[model samples]
Every structure is written in C-alpha cells, then in structure tokens.
Target: MKRIWKQVQQTLRILGAGILAILVLVSSTVPGGERLEQVRAYTRGVEFDYAGWMLAALWDKGQQWALSAPRYWDEKTQRQVVEDWAALTREVQALRAESARIFADPSVSDPQTAAAPVLARLRAREAEQARLGALSEEILQIQTRAVLAEMGLTYGKQAVPSVLYRISKLPLALVVSPREVIRQDANISLLPDMGLDEITALEQRVEQELGVSALVVQIGGVAVYPAMVMETTNLVYLTDTVAHEWTHNYLTLRPLGMLYDASPELRSMNETAASLAGKEIGLRVLERYYPDLVPPPPAP
Candidate 1:
C-alpha cells in the first residue's frame, strides 16, 4: 500500500512540473505575439499626426491664395471642390483625434521608450512626401503649359478650362488615369500602347485564378477600383496608396492585427491618414507649379 502511494505522489509531481514548463513557454511567446500589433499602432499614430498637420497647413495656404485670385473656375465646380476639401479636413481632424487616443492608451504598450526613433520615421515620411510633391508639381506645370500653348493657337490668349479627374473601377483592382479637361468615353483601345482586349482577358483570368474579388487599373493617370475610395495616378496619390497598403503589411506583423483582426475604426483611421497625406503632398506639388490653380476656400 505504501509503495503504491509513493508512486502516485511521484506521478503528480511530474505532472505539476510539466504544467509549469508549459506556462513558462506560453508567457515568453505570448508577449511576442502581441508585439507586432503594438508596433503597427505606433507607426500608424505617427503617420496620422504628421499627415493631419501637413494637410491643415496646406489647405490654409491654398485657401488664402485662392481667395486673392481672379474668379477663373465655374461657380458650381469651384464650390464642389471646396466642399470636398472641407470634408477632407474634417476627416483628417477626426483621424488625428483617434490617433492621439490610441497613443495615450496605457493598455497598448510601446516597448520602445525613446521617441527619437519614431521621430526619425516621421521625418522620412515627410521627406518622401516632399519629393513626390515636387514631381507632381513638375508634371502639372508641363500639362498647364500644354494647355496654354493650345489656347494661344486657338484664341490668342490663355483660357483655363475645367479640370476633371476620375478613377475607373474593376473588381479587386484600381487604375489611375490622367486628368482630363473635358469628359469623354475612355479610349480603352489606345491605353498604354498595349492590347486592351488582351490585357482585360488576362486580368480576368488572373482574378479567377487567384480568387480575388477585384483589381486596380490605371487609365491615363486615374485609379479605378471597386473599393470605397476614388483612385488616382498622381505620384502623390500613388505614394499614399502605397503607404496605406504598407500599413496593412505592417499590421499583419503585429499583435494588434492578430488579436483585433483589423477592427473597422482602426482601418478607417489608417486609410484616412494615408488619404490626408496624399492630398497634402499632392497640393504641395500644385502650389509649386500651378500657383494660379490654387484650391478654393472652405464655405462659411
């Protein structure tokens, strides 16, 4: 009887040690699982803050300039663009507020105590925004010059026509097209010096093979996709698209993404920041080259 009791105690002791070992392994691995989420959140916070500031500053400057210029644009179109700008500004402010709340949350831990590294990342994004903005401005100036030359030939004076921008949508994809002054049916056949039918067929086949719901396509510098947002071919637009997509990639690496499965509000905040940044950088380009084409002021 005593021998049997001793054997039972030994078995229980072994089981207890096994349980303890498992607990230790889990504790060590669990923190790592959450680390990625924390980092993604941190990066997003930085992006939102910087983007909001840039856009607000750009809009203020642009609006003031527009107000001082002669009335060149149609009243309806001008009002519409001004309204869009106001809406975008509101969105940026909301994103900034949300980002601040996330940063302040103690539950979301940032292991990196030093703010220096974070600041460096922000600066890099800013520099990238500046470079892309310059490129966009250069392209706009070229287009504007072309418009002026055409006007001179026909009317002996420059006339600013309506500028219209659009994005075409396809399943699971986006395409950015160039800005057009007059609306017309897109000439799919002449796009990109490639066979339009063949490319469309290929895209369909690829989508079927990959089982994706949609694809993005660029036609004349405008982006088209089924996604909720309008797309653009502008370098600044592309930069923001790339940045937003990259945030998704970064989130996948973190614990919050894993744990939260990318909550709706989180995704909104992410996209909003990217959108704001794109517009901010895009406007900087406009200001540098098309100074006469300044964005109008928000409605009172």
Candidate 2:
C-alpha cells in the first residue's frame, strides 16, 4: 500500500512537471508556443472591467426576452428557406452598397431621381428578408427552448432569443495567425486566403522572417472561434454559435465569467462551457426542425 501511494505521488508529480514544461514551451519559441510573448504583452495589467458593457447586454437581453415571439410558417413556406433567403440577402446587400455609393456626395442635390430605384429595391429586399428572417428565428427559437428544457436552464424573464440568423460576411477582415485576435466592437478578421498554404506560408513567414514563433492553428472552416460573433453567414453554425455567445453573455453576471481573465483555466472553462451548451442547443435544433438529418434514435 505504501509503495502504491508512493507510485501515485510520483505519477502526479510527473503530470505537473509535464504541464509546467508545456507552459514554458508555449511561452518559448516553439511552433505551438509562439503566442507566449504576444500574449504576455497583450495581457499586461489588463483590468478586465467589462462589466459596464456586460450590464448593458444583460438589460438588452431582458428586453429581448420580453419581445413578441417570431411568427411560425408552415412546412410549405419553409421549404428552400435557406437558399432563397441567402439569395435575397445578397441582393439586399448589393442594393445597400449601391445606395450608399450613389448618395455619398453632399454637393449632389436632387438625388431622389438617381436614388429612387435603389432605395425602392433596398426597401423591397429589406421587407422580404425581414419576413424570411422571422421564420428562421422561429425555427431557431424552438431549438433554444428545447435545449433550455433539456438542461433545466432558465430564461429568467427573458423572452425567446431572437436568433434571426442571416449570412452576412463582414465586408472586411484583417486576418491573423495563431489566434491573436484583432477585434473591436464585435468585428474581427476573416481568413481571406484561397488555400491553406497561403495562410500557412503567411504564418511561417511571420515567424521565420520576424524571428518569432507562429504556427497555423489548424482551423479548417469558414467559422472563426470566439470571434465568430463578428459576422457570420453559415446558418448551420450560426444557430449554435449564437448560443455559444449568449452563454458568455449569460455567464457575464456570474462569477465564472467575471473571473475569465483572472487565469487561462477560467477562460478555458467559460469558453468550454459555452461551446458544449451551444453544440447541445444546435443538436436540439437538428432534432426538432431537421429530423431528416438526424440519425435514428437507439432502440431499447
């Protein structure tokens, strides 16, 4: 028994040493450990006093909770919703761009004739998109509600979340490597490269030429992490991603989220919780709305 206890202690010591070594490497000039100095520089004396805005978010969430529910449509109307809505959104975005370009001049008086057609088109697109957006919201809300029921989570005087998903890639993104996020006011960069080698070479050049450590983080999708809230167009991910973000918002009022910046572990915990919950919520959406896509339930 004594020998067994000694072995247990030895195993624990080895684990701790391994973790410490990894941390040192992460802070060193290794491929996977490149963010060490950058992270240190970014986090120096950071106050993490995000409560001011988080409170606003909480209040807005309450208001959202009290809002009227989205109108549901029959299956006939729901068919081809994703493809059709995406097309309309593209048209709407184009019209909006045209309107802005045509109306950018302050010196140009009597712009009505030139702007009327564009404005009319914009209005029509907006109207149609709003209707379709509402239907999508209804579909998502069903999943959100189902997840809440499954997890015994409380909406807490909040009405159903307005998960009115639309695919709108932000017009611009300043892509970065190794998860060094350049974000402001909910805007983040998207990877704009045509192939993996481009981003990989960029990261390699950043490290090799700059004498720093940066390796590709192996992210292989249109979806960005944590910052996916920046702007998204994929409905398949939008539902769960929105839930993940809202979980962060919900955790804002709790000790867990508040202490997010206190340590890496807490931040990981917070994000992990959000991701787990978000995936579950997305699965609920599939189960309830896209049953055709769901796998067969297990037999007794």
Candidate 3:
C-alpha cells in the first residue's frame, strides 16, 4: 500500500503542475480567472479515475478485491435486498440531516468540528452503511448492467468485460470561485483514491498560493467526474447518472468531446447533449423496470 501510494503521489504532482499551467494560460487574464479555472477543471475530466494512470498501477490488487468479494444478494432475494437497502439508506440520510442541522446551530461551541452528538450520529450512520453494503454488491451488478443493456451500452469480453468495483468514489474536487465571488463554483476532479486529509490540504495550499477562492467538494454523483463504484437503491437517479457518465465516456472518443478543452462553448455543448441523451435513456429504463416512476412524455 505504501509503495502504491508513493506512486500515486508522484503522479498527482505531475498532473497538478501540468494542468495548472493550462488553467493559468486559458483566459487567466480575464476578470477573475474563474472561467479559465473552470475550463482547466472540465478538460481534465476524470483523468485520475477509472481510465486514469493512477489506477493502472493498482488495478490488479483492486480487481482481485472486487472479484473475490462474497455475494450476499441473489436472484431470489434481489427484490428484498433492494427494498431493505432503500429503507436503510433513507434512515441514514435522515440521521445525516439531523446531524447537519445540529452542526449548523450557531449556539453550539463549535460546529465545524464533530462534537459528542455528531460522533454519536456518525456511529449510527456507519451502522446503517454496513447494512446497506452487505447486499449492495449483487444489487449493483444486476441493476447497473440491466440499465446499460437497456440503453444499448454493452461490450463483449474482448472490448471490456465484467467491471466490478469494491468502493464508491473518493473525488478530491478542488473548487474555485471567481475572485470577485465568495463561494465555490468551479473545480478540477481528483483521483477516487486520494485521502481526505491529503485533498483538503491541497485545496488550502492552492487557495493560498493562487490567492483564489478554493475548497474541496468530497461528495458523489457529480456529472463532471467519474465514480469507480456506482450503486444506489434510488433507481431513478442510479439509472440516470450511470447513463450520464457513460455518455461522457462515449463522447470522449468523438469530435465534440475530443475538442472539449479547445473552447468553452464546446464543453457546454458536450454536457447539454449528454444530458438530453441520458434523460431519454433513463426514461427507457423507467418504462421497463419501474413504470410507475416514468414521467409522461410532453404534449405533442
């Protein structure tokens, strides 16, 4: 693990330096360099994730873990597993929301850091996550592939076979706002494996060095980035986001996606086009699997 991390760090340094230059030059002279930074972020895409170089160094170990995991959900119990997962996930979200509400209370001594109550809430969250993860593997496998096949985005073994992942995303997003603004607005996506502390430190360093507004957004389902392991009991979003990212993967090989970095308008076009296609594809999945959730087509 130590050796792998060393290699990953070396790669990050190289990537950050190279990409930062592109940002500094691409319309950096503009008002606050926000658009330039946004371009730099979007163009870089998920280079540190699934198709990135860092994972190439550790794919064998990662694949071994993924393929070797034991199955907890089968065809017979698939529906039950999904239903249970959905319940637990909602419970977890409620607990998190409560915790967030508590932290946001200005009356507290310090909300930025976790307090005793927050720690208790964290424990509850972890318990719910453990239950959710128990049956997640089988559920994700069946659901993601079904959506992919329904959307006609499948590849044989020769092209690419059996993508099994053991973890969710670890996106280290470096969000930059216009100097004239006060909040985060743009970002460059980082590797899925980067440590939280490491990424947070980088966010701070970048902000201080560049004298720009910067922060790290450590969340998931971001359209601009790639997630290694994507699974959710929320069928609606799960189907839509999976198709959305895959559309990006497809576009990367075409003319529009290839020249994404050359112009701002081109990047917008790529996102807009992918969104429309993904919505259509998501509707197809809805019609087949969960007809009740399907929205009626617009008036003709």
Candidate 4:
C-alpha cells in the first residue's frame, strides 16, 4: 500500500512538471518577444499568477479524485446539484444587488447596519456556492468527457488532454494592436480582481507609452490546462465555454493548434472550429443530461 501511494505521488509530480513546461512553452510563443516584454513591464505587479492558479486547481482535483465524490452520486443527484448551483447563483446575485442598493442610498445614514442581514445571507450563499460550484464543475467535466468519447473525440476512452477546468473569476486579457493596422501584437492576462478604472488606466498607459492600440477584454474562458472558465449563472454558456476551451486543448496537440499563431487566418480557423465544436458538444451534453434546460428549435 505504501509503495502504491508513493507511485501515485510520483506520477502526479511528473504530470505537474509536464503541465508547467507546456504552459511556459506557450507563453514563450507570444508574438514579438520584445513587445511581450514591454507589455509585461507594465503588467509586472498585476499579472495573473498562472502557476499559482494551476497548482491550486490541481490540488482541488487531486482531493476530488482521492474521494471520488461525484461517483457516489447518481445521475439524478448530479443533475439536482447542477440545478441548485444555478439557482443559488441567482440568489447570490440578487442579494448583492440589494446590498449595493442599501449602501448606495443617500438617505440611509447607517448603510452597514441596514445591509447587515443581506451581507450575512450573501456570505452564507457564497459558501454554499463554493461547495456546489466545485461538485458541479466535476460533474460537468465527467459528462463532457463521456459525450466527447461518444463523438470519438477521445483516445483509449479518455480525452486527449483530459477534461479539466475550474469555474472561477477569469483573468482580463490585454490585447495590443498596432496603431496603423488592426492586428493583434500581444495578448496577456491580468489579475482577475482588477476593476474597470484600473483596466482603463492600464490600457491607456500601455497605448501612450508604446504608441499602440490596446484593449482590456473580459474573456468568458481561457484555454489553460485545467482551463480557466469564468463563473456565470447561465448553464448553457458555462457548458459551451468549457467545451470550447477543451477543444483548444485538443487542437494543441495537432498541427492546427500548433500553428495557432502562424497567421491571422489560422487563428480564425482555430477559434471558429472550437466555437462550432463547442456548441455541438455542449448541446449534446444538455440534451443527454439536462434536457429541460436545452432551448427549443427556432420557428421555421
């Protein structure tokens, strides 16, 4: 038993090293090495910690794997968890709005006092959200893998890169374009918690200093290993984004994804392919597991 445990630990260590190497290689491929450095200088302190996030996500996955928690639950229980997660997300959003209203009202002398109950409830809901969020994410990953396997988008009954993701606050992307031409020069990730004012300020500074067109874009998902999926209440969007990122991972091992930065045309092809495949896979997952949530066909 002890030897088996050690082997498991060794395997995970090797896997961690491999994932780190892949991410680093991809980062090194950012167009214009010097230009990437320039962008990094401005984003030095505020850059998203990819390594840290990956480690945290992997640790969570390891915990889940050890317990095999989702396997214990039947299909019905899994569906219920997903539904509850969506409803709880809405409840949390409404609570946030109420809390904001109370705090923002000029007539309220003691906003904190008035907002105390709402805040308390918000905290409780958020805690529950975290719990359900983790479980639901795993459930969705398993479902997606099964669907992909059926579609023959798998090898040896497993996804090529494996379906791993975490639904959390996603990082903001800083896209740089040449002033004279509308071309992407650099794309970098910023810390997730940055506010609009900070995002605007950074974009302005980068543009002014580099004489380039810059935009801070909110991405629904990023194709990182254990892909970074944005937290959302919409199940359809969530599932679609997950599959979309997974497609990117799938393509990464092929010539298409390998040459993703080869040309603007290739970039378009890669994205279009992912988008199309993601929607199809997402729809199939819904049709099989969450049939009620699937939207009806359009009028003829």
Residue 108's lDDT within candidate 4 is 100
Task: Pull out the clashing pairs in model 2.
Answer: 65-158, 65-159, 167-233
Structural similarity to truth (TM-score) of each candidate: 0.23, 0.44, 0.54, 0.89
State the C-alpha lDDT per candidate. 0.35, 0.48, 0.54, 0.84
Residue 128 in candidate 4, Cα distance off native in Å: 1.1
Off by over 4 Å in 3: 1-76, 103-125, 128-131, 134-138, 157-234, 298-300
Error of 2 at 30 (Å): 28
Comparing 1 with 4 on lDDT, the higher-scoring candidate is 4
**Candidate No. with top TM-score:** 4
Candidate 1 lDDT over residue span 1-300, tens digit each = 885565456434434433432233223222232333333232222221222222333333233323322234443444344334334444444544555665677776772343345555555554554433333322332333334344342133421211112122212212112233222111121123234564566446434543333232442231110011233333344333432332332333345333322344554564465456445544443454344555676699
Q: What lDDT tens digits, residue by residue, belong to model 2 across residues 1-300?
A: 885565456434434433432233222211123344343332223212222322333333333334423324455455457447657777887888888877886866867778998898799888998676545544555456555666657655332222222223222222234335422111122233325765465556545554444443322222111112322345556667767655664564478855654555776798799889877777676666666655556599
Among all candidates shown, the one with the greatest lDDT: 4
1 versus 3: better TM-score goes to: 3
RMSD for each of the candidates: 27.6, 15.9, 10.2, 2.9
Query: Between 1 and 2, whose lDDT is larger?
Result: 2
Output the TM-score of candidate 3: 0.54
TM-score of 4: 0.89
